[model samples]
Target: MNNNLGLHETLELHELLLFKNTCLTKANTLSEVAQDQELKNILKADAKASQSEIQDIQKFLS
Candidate 1:
């Protein structure tokens, strides 16, 4: 996809991507030592979704 993003838009996209990356990392870290099975499951699911989101955003940015 052609980026065609203006400076402001590009910066906003970069910020959003960074935020998503941070959330994904947090989800992964939490899931690792999560004790409650249910909570762990939820975290894992969220992490999976976050990963997908990151991939999508990266695809768009690139």
Candidate 2:
């Protein structure tokens, strides 16, 4: 089955991957300095979402 995306879609996906990576990095940094459980949980959730987005981007690139 053909799975190639248009150029615009590919670029958009690339941007999303970059954004997700950035968010994951920020989340990790925040997690280390997080004093409250709620803050930590929020960062953890953001990191997870970023990871999921990265996976989706990978699939699209493939």
Q: What is the lDDT for 53 in model 1?
A: 89
Cand. 2 Cα-lDDT? 0.86
RMSD of 2: 1.8
lDDT for each candidate structure: 0.86, 0.86
Return the TM-score for candidate 1, rounded to 2 decimals.
Answer: 0.88
Candidate 1 residue lDDT tens string, 1-62: 63587888777878988998999899989989989999999999998998998888787678
Pairs of residues clashing in candidate 1: none
Q: What is the TM-score of each candidate against the true structure?
A: 0.88, 0.85
**For model 1, what is the error of residue 57's alpha carbon versus the real structure, in angstroms, after optimal superposition?**
0.7
Query: How much does candidate 2 score in TM-score?
Result: 0.85
